[model samples]
Target: MTDPERELNFAREIIGQRGFRDVPTDEVLGEAERLLNGWMAGDFRMERPKLYDHYALLLLALLQKNRDLEARIEALEARDA
Candidate 1:
């Protein structure tokens, strides 16, 4: 089972027009920090400012990921039921 609603909400909140276009600076930095610790720790050159350049791409990828997960969950539920 999966919390599709929660997953969708997270994506929706982030992908909304105002949310994506005018994300809070503090929250943006916080997101980059988490990425730094988990994914870019090995690459010291991937700084926070560089992340801003790819912010839109990152959010779009997140939306795609959410869609994929939703599809996967639906498939599993249909198969099981």
Candidate 2:
């Protein structure tokens, strides 16, 4: 018979050794969270995306950066035009 607790601990240790890190729920944004859910559910066609915690956070940051840049550019154009 397998001890569930022991098995869990062993699995956690293996994950740790494999460089798996935890991302808190609060740290994940809505879009990234949705993306992660879809990725996990295999809802996408073609190649699967990297949906890890770090990847999610990075993607969110990139998206925000893109939004900010676009807004700034639009404001500058409006002011100049």
Candidate 3:
């Protein structure tokens, strides 16, 4: 099956099993429609690449430098104790 079909099937399975009657299905569907319309209209022409780049940078900075910061803080605390 195509990716869209697969995604829809997955969503349907989850929604069906969870019995999301209390949740606003209309609102969720409307948001999906709006997002698809925006993509079809090319609203993400520049923003998509920027979002990918920014997300990658954020992941790298957080995963790499954050660990270094934690180690440095631990060393400082040990020295003072």
Question: Root-mean-square deviation of each candidate, in angstroms?
Answer: 14.9, 11.9, 13.5
Better of 1 and 2 by lDDT: 1
lDDT of 2 at 79: 100
- Model 1, 1-81: lDDT tens digits are 323232222323333566554665445445545554544444233434545656664566556667878999999999999
Error of 1 at 19 (Å): 25
Which candidate's lDDT is highest?
1
- Once superposed on the true structure, which residue ranges of model 3 sit more than 4 Å away at CA? 1-50
Tell me how many clashing residue pairs each candidate has.
0, 0, 0
Better of 1 and 3 by lDDT: 1
TM-score: model 3 vs. ground truth: 0.35
Q: Estimate each model's TM-score.
A: 0.41, 0.37, 0.35
> Best TM-score goes to which candidate?
1
For model 2, how does the per-residue alpha-carbon lDDT over 1-81 read when each residue is reduced to its tens digit? 333233122222223344323533233344454544554565522122322324645455557667878999999999999
